[model samples]
Target: MRLSGRAALAVGLAGAVLAPVTPAFAAPPPVTADLRADVDRNGRVDITGTGDQTGEDTWSAGRGAVFLPNIDDDAKRCRTTGPDGKPLSDAKLAKCNDAADTTVNGAADAKDLARLRTVPMAQAPKDASGTVRVTGKGAKHARLFIKRAGGWTAVTAKTTLTAAELRAGVELGLEGTDVVRDRAVWDGSAVVELKVTAGSTTTSDKVTLHVAPLLTQHHLQRAQRMLVTEIQGKGPFSRAQQKFVKDLDTQAKKAGVKQSTVKFTKYGDIWAQDFVEPAYAGMTGEDGRPRTIRIMLRSAQPDREAGRELFEKLRGPDMGVVQVTGVKDSEEWTLNSMGNLETIPPYTHGGRSYPAGRIIMGERKDTGSKPAKAMRTLLASQGLQNPLFLDTSWLHVGHVDEFVQFLPAPGTPRGWRIGVADPDAGMKLLRDAKAAGHGKTKMFSVKGFEGMPAPKETIDQTLADKKLRADNALAAKRIKANLEVLKRETGVTDAEIVRVPALFTRGTDEGVAADRMPLLRRIGGSADTPEAVREYGQQRELGKPTGPSVMTSAYVPGAVNGVLLGPDRYLAPRQWGPVIGGKDIFTQAVTAAYRKAGFKVSYIDDYYTYHLGMGEVHCGTNTLRDTTKPWWRP
Candidate 1:
């Protein structure tokens, strides 16, 4: 049989699977008696056979060679009869000559060394001079890759072999047969590629690899997404909005951000400044029961210094709702005083007396003083130690612009309906006129003070007026104006800011005629048809039908229901104009903001009699551990 270099390499490789080559006809076969009796080693019979014994030893392993004991003093050669016994092919004769021509192990000649030199090596890449390729059955797999001199170049897997593997020559194969037809070639300085397929799966073994560029990797890891909070009417925030700000620090910490980074800013003290009542009615709790609220106070507004710090610490953790609180700072008042607030029991109302109160009554009657103290007491009762104040009074709750812009828009619940009221009488007059119809006269009554008795309205004329539609435009303006103020204060211009239009200041009695009243009044009362009343109070019918306004300045049921059920659109009503309770409003607003930002949210539902009674965290815990060094505290 003619032995191909490929086949020889394969057989050779089969012997040492680590890195093998095929077999060659140059080696003498074992089992021959001629070579066996002429035993070179003492006491050993080295029988060997010449190859190409195809017909003679077709199915047997030891057929061509045999050994027998010899009694002669000198060794003798054993010869086989030509075609009678084991016939040797010309290839076999040449192989015998080659083996006989050489020492058993370097026992003989120059011809054997020359034959070894003729073995071929697996080739590298075609275009690339240094690249080499190799393959084998159960070959030790290794991945190879290169960074091209100038730029990245994609190459096949098989073309590149490791330098170490290249140093030690390996056998190559194609479809299990030893062949050079399927090895890899180089492609210049660019990467050389090769592939080996087994079954249906192929791995990137022996690939031309490269190093990654530093510049591109750096920017990809660090890039932020701008959100804007919309303002409704009057000031930038209510007390509840402030509360959200205060709690943001805690929220950030809980979300795993560093404490110093999470922070807030005070716009104006809710206590010190006179407040504007929210433009809607609010809920009437289980009759005579005091409502619970919370807020956050801060000494400074969160800026870039704080922002960057927060950004680094926040990393990817999510912040839930922020909270705000007002801090009352007066030399005369002490934070530790137990008698600072008065507790009131739940009073009976709507034929029911409910349980309530860790009610704190303060001696100072200042509305500003009450909110701060109430907040402090609330937080303290909740076991919050070292809880620093945000800022006093002026708590405007907001967040980073990027965070808000990414938040999804608020959605309405199914079966949602609209209700309206005019905390200000402007909307009421328009509603009454619309109900009264063109050019009509009607009777109206106004409540009187003390024993003076109620004033009887003998005649009130209603003009059939198209100008009555003015209320809608005014309401829209109020919402727009409110939002504009917020936008200016926040510096968050990215989000789309759309205002709810068509609300007006309602008037008491047949008081100020819509025509006689000044064009811009924010509050008052009105006597309109109940349906008109509903329309005005809810502010839903003023324009294209929209969602109802929940809480408002007006004392109306529609507004109350809105605050409870339609949390997304409720307006926080201030109790006494300038001095108002803000904890509830701020809390809800902050919660809503967080919900918008893709956070997992749920109500704080703990037994917070003492804590909540003063208006504090019913659910959240402060996760901000002290990181300050001992020396820093002083």
Candidate 2:
């Protein structure tokens, strides 16, 4: 990968040949004026032709342009505030990677400067002076910086700066002022060119640049640091949650991955992966080092600054944080949350394989619940992972991850296979255990776990509940339909997919539509207190038609929602299952299923912490995987 452009002066640059762009003026202006951007995104600007050639002038997928993201790549301590008296500057949320503030002393930092291309005058007359500007629909939204004196200084469009040395060259860097708000609003396109006039002649070269696409994911996890929220208190999070942290720490350390914990107890949602997308743009520097960015999802879950908070904590070197928000108070709000997001590992279907794999998110079947227009547009624009959707409307939490997971399978032909919830399989496992004379075994039978009361019911009593049976049956039907969708999209055979033993139970309409949803809510009192949620899903409520007739939560914390330590090591939430002879039947079944897929599994007891809270181990912890793979290669 090398950046190629035209019109390099005789500065004795060895590699590329001298190719001057055609001057617009009739008379030769004492020198040929040329502006070279990284038209070919190999990381450096190499002059390849004499004039308007493909790689030098145009931008395309493989080798035509440069890619930079609308990300927050620079910051510092500034005790200032925006309109809302928050803090003046959080260097993290602030995307303006420039020096100083106001309209005065701001200059582009060195790292941010390197992220973009440098449009320099290759070979111009020493006296040759001209004006440079950005043109196109998004021209004004981008800033042009001139490298002079000490550092890079931001210059307005068509700004005439200091004279060129005409010996080496003059460097002018281009930086994106904002992210792609929406495809309809701005499409990330701009052209930086130069018009130098010396005596009578003037010439220019235009190279188009597309704001970088957010690259998708692969199965191989090279964890830099594993993240888990550590909040132990009386309110929402309990001692069980702390125990979950300890368990995850043990697992992470065993896998040779470092683990970090978030001490902030503001938000109740412990799913770190939901707020912070472990994302990377797959763009390399001039030295071939890969750049990664954590694109925080602009989620609207009570606290609006969920984006800002995650950005502040997670942003670091080469890893910037970007938040593309959406229409407030709409389906775009909850649907765009990262809990609903999952990446289908690289697979071939109908002879076509996605190199970056495909991004899969949940959407409503009856009344569509998709991501924000800006987010959907940005995700689709990535080109590698063509996003596909499934009907997660039936889920009370409404996330694809609850039922589906893509695990790395080295023994398989595709190198990965689907690990999905099988309600029927779960029911069968229960029946089988019962048939083996374990029908009277009591469940939720762990000794000293804190939080919700362990349901003191036998397997016989659980199977006898009409409501529970109906709910799991509904879940089974829905899971089958979802599986069909997955099978059609990615050419995975039934044999290749592993069926996890998982069950579901319906929750009330009141719980689903609450301000702070997805809680480990269990109403006290009544014969079957926890199971007695006033179920409502069929009808349209408050003009937002929730199409699914039955919406349900995991009766047994869906084992499919487990986290991966690596391709071969898996961490699953412990099923506080009924003991038969010596082991929990549910735990044994879950372990067996994963082992069949070539994964060594260890169970983390998330019963009181995440299971009761409508989540599991994967929800409580997030991994920043090694996504430095070739964006264009499978």
* Model 1, span 1-634: residue lDDT tens: 5557776676676874533333553432211111011111111222224222222222111122111100011111212225567544322321221122212121111111100000111332222122323233212121112323332222244345342333233222111000011113111111212332222322222311111100000001111110111112232122323344344333443434432432212222111101110000011112222111111111111211211211122212111011122333332221112112221222223333212211222222212333343334433432202122211111010001100111112332111111222223333433444455511322222233223333232222222232333434443344344334333432324343311111222222222222212211221121111221122111211122111221111111111111110122221121111101233222333334334433333332111111111111210111121111110011
Cα lDDT of model 2 by residue, 1-634, tens digit: 2233444443246556654455554443256555666554556655446332355555555555544553543444322356687753434355443322312123323434433322344555556676677787757566667767766666665467334543345666665555555556676677777676665677666677766566545556566567766654543334556677877888878877765644434444455556556666645555665544445444433234444556455544444555554445544444666777788877777877776778898887767667666667777765557689898878876788889998887767788888889889888888888888888888556654334444677888878878778988988888889989988888788888999998888766554423113232342222222221112111112343355656777877678888888767888888877887788888999999998888899888876556665667776667777766656556
Per-residue lDDT value at 371 in model 2 = 67
Candidate 1 structure, TM-score to reference: 0.18
**Each model's backbone clash number:** 109, 7
Best candidate, lDDT-wise?
2
Which prediction has the highest TM-score against the true structure? 2
lDDT of model number 2: 0.63
Cα misplacement distance, residue 262 of candidate 1 (Å): 5.7
